[model samples]
Target: MNDDQATPNPTKDRKFVEALSRGLDVLRAFSQGSVVLGNQDISRITGLPKPTVSRMTYTLTKLGYLAYSPQLEKYQLDSGVLALGYAYVSNLRVRQLAKPYLDEFARNTNTSVGLTCRDRLSMIYVENCRPAEITSLRMDVGVRLPLATTAAGRAYLAAMKEEERRHVMSSLAERHPDTWPELKQQLEESFRDYEKYGFCLSLGDWDRNVNAAGVALHLQDGTLMALTCGAPTYLVSEEKVKNQLAHQLAILARDIERLGV
Candidate 1:
């Protein structure tokens, strides 16, 4: 199932193991720059009790998912964590199936093209194709952009069923309580544009220097994915993105959907 789809709360589900969830949360507290984290740091980030954080850290460290640093008194993610992500990607063949078409599209548009899917509150890039020349947005596999602000994410939201879209919006509201009002308005506009153009545009919304447009499609296995192409704001104007690139992205989405992979 798409990770974006809401699952039953582990806290309320009798069969759910809350400990596992907490352990994962502790690991997630570490990001690209914040690689090493102490128990108190994790507690503050995850809002878990200090004692619980200690226990989870110790358990994860013993399981090889986290490695404790003796000199710094902090924990860092170990290579074992990559195995989990690798397992997930190895099972999803979309990247392999979409690479050639994405490559051609990137070359034709002289922009950066990416294939991404909804992952919790963000869109995670699974495949990226770049033209020979350098581009403004430098994204690789595993890069994540906020779902409420990115073109790929907006397209994904626009393509979802109304009930699913509402559920996702409510979750976004809770996660970003302060920015939800403005984000909601932006998303409403995107939905209207999608209805008229078959795609959505994000013009310097996520990043001031970059502009992207995207279209979403469902694969043969019923997995929802988005195709996005982006370049520097000066190079790719909103008019060009909406009139030219958006149609190309929509055609690529349809081609991938026809692949039935």
Candidate 2:
């Protein structure tokens, strides 16, 4: 059999398979900018074929994860996805522990704060506190940012265990050539610098006008997520804010760690 084909594995094979993953991916493909998608759009966004996306959409609609607009011939994410994400987030130990600290950080800094965990090659927002100025972008709960672009994602990558870090960075190298450069030496140097400082600062790496800084909030299990702060570049410039903001974020992380948050 080819590598693309499923291997015969007695130990790994399971009777209770998961359509859950594919369905969730389809739902995730619908985002803030693209609220509804036709089969072709879904196919392009998800890398799934048109026929497979059509079948999944039909099944998802039946299961209530999607709702189809007959006039537009497009599918929009239904309320069911909220319930799924809500259930997961509601039960997460990190979200529970991070909320109060995030709130405090936002209030103290008078800036927006977010907590993000690694999800595949993306960073999934778990908690956030946005001041009105920052909320203008409508960056709210359940936002996923590219791991190679955002400060929180870079911070998480910087904090990853050795083997896991190699795997994720390698995948990023393969998947995003235009965005991800082939500069291995520079990447390693940046990671080392972040490790020395305990945080990472990104300037216009994700969004051209957005400046962000983040520090890892470590868990006892050796897993870590990031506490991130972001603003428009006009408000926080690259030359002015990287050191100060990173220090502040690191302090917050230390406090949270001491408090076991």
Candidate 3:
């Protein structure tokens, strides 16, 4: 059924609401970090009753948005979901607006450069460019990465409105129990740096052997995206990574801003 023609506020009605909202909630319970969830776990996470969650899970599995892992008895998002997300990005202004700049950065730096945007709580890769020599780190379009532990995520977080940032921090506290303290400190420092100099850098924080730097691509519409450069530790030192790449990053940001990224 079309979204506009679907039951209106069926959540208030006892009949159609069960299959409508609960199914969507079941799909939402899975994320980049939360790839699979058992019925009980889904119930706890979504605040839906155990039986309701069970029915919703079964329904979704039948509908192809989710798959049932018999060994784990957990549900995971299927590849079919990518069709929906990719359709949105394929038509996005950011992809067209940021493409040439990313291509130029990769050519100049001879390293990987990418553009990512905030999707609720995760960072979705919209564009990527890398040198032909680097064959290990295979980043694809539409790949979702956790924002709390990525340079692009931290940069986006730092650029958000104060209230939105608070909500993100709260959700991070709840979603990531192990990395909360370190992530919080990193976020604070990055935000300060971004505000002071309009760019952010992280070294070996997201992954122990990788380094990255990023700058905000702020558009006039209040929507923000981040352009980031990522490479191995040996290739990106603290001084050169932050001081040098930051300048190039700023120029790219300006170019994107002019085009409204």
Candidate 4:
């Protein structure tokens, strides 16, 4: 059975391990707003067999990544998962070092500033700073956005190494054959804009409620990340983003990079 719940990895070599893949798919089955899941639920989500999901879930529970509920007869992520996620955040020194700058920028601009890192074919928010008064935008840490359409994702593609970007784009195109052409054109334009302004814009392109500009940062730790700053559409215009927010985000991205240096 094919397990393509998240992004599809286009190339699989002989070193690939199916069992490990299935196990990770089982974990990926637990998504945002998903509380608990039984083997059947995971099976349907991952397209794996019920028996295989049962075996994988049992193994995961034994390893402390999952906890079983006796009354509900389902499983939920446990401490092991939290530890892994926490370790990732803790090791990213940029998250701690950049927060103050982000907060200051967000507070001054009345916009939301978010730090994101690429995960597979999407970008996941690592740190978020928003003005307390702004309540329309809801992006926070752990929120994931599509790689092809988002300002953050386009900035990531513009900044990533060519070979790595090609690999990711291949998977994206293969997965979204119908939309890839248009999205690819937009990404190319974003690249040119990134060259001129050091930032990319998605003015209601991804979410109509949001108007955002993004820029990329290359940390001293060899990590590549993206930064986005935006407000709700009603509060910001495309010209305002290009003339104001974009420059602020680009400057913040450079300052954040200097911290890692």
Each model's lDDT comes to 0.86, 0.75, 0.77, 0.85
Candidate 4 at residue 121, lDDT?
69
How would you order the candidates by TM-score, starting with the best? 1, 4, 2, 3
* Per-residue error (Å), model 2, residue 4: 17
Tens digits of lDDT, candidate 4, 1-261: 322223444365666777898898888788634789999889988889999999999999999999999999999999999899989987878888998999899989999999999877678899998987789787877888887788899999899888878877777877677888988888889989988879898988899888999999898867788998888888888889999889988988888777754
Candidate 4 residue spans exceeding 4 A from truth = 1-18, 70-72
| Residue range with the least summed lDDT across 10 consecutive positions in model 3 | 1-10
Give the alpha carbon lDDT tens digit for every residue of 19-114 in model 3: 676677677677525878899888877778899888888887887888999999888998667678778878888778778878888878866888
Q: What is the per-residue lDDT of model 2 for residues 125-214, given as tens digits with 9 covering 90 to 100?
A: 888887666655446778888777777878887888888788777677776657555444445655876878877877776788888887
Query: After superposition, which runs of candidate 1 have C-alpha atoms over 4 Å from their true positions?
Result: 1-7
Judged by lDDT against the true structure, how good is candidate 1?
A: 0.86
Candidate 3 is scored at a TM of 0.80
lDDT of 1 by residue, 160-254 (tens): 99988999998888877788899899999999999999999899899988889988878877788888899998777888888899998999999
Candidate 1: 10-residue stretch with minimal lDDT? 1-10
Q: Looking at candidate 3, what is the lDDT of residue 5?
A: 12
Backbone clash tally (model 2): 0
Per-residue lDDT value at 33 in model 1: 44
**Each model's TM-score, in the order given?**
0.93, 0.82, 0.80, 0.89
Candidate 3 Cα outliers beyond 4 Å, as residue runs: 1-21, 30-47, 61-64, 67-80, 176-179
Q: In model 4, which residue pairs have backbone atoms overlapping below 3 Å? A: none
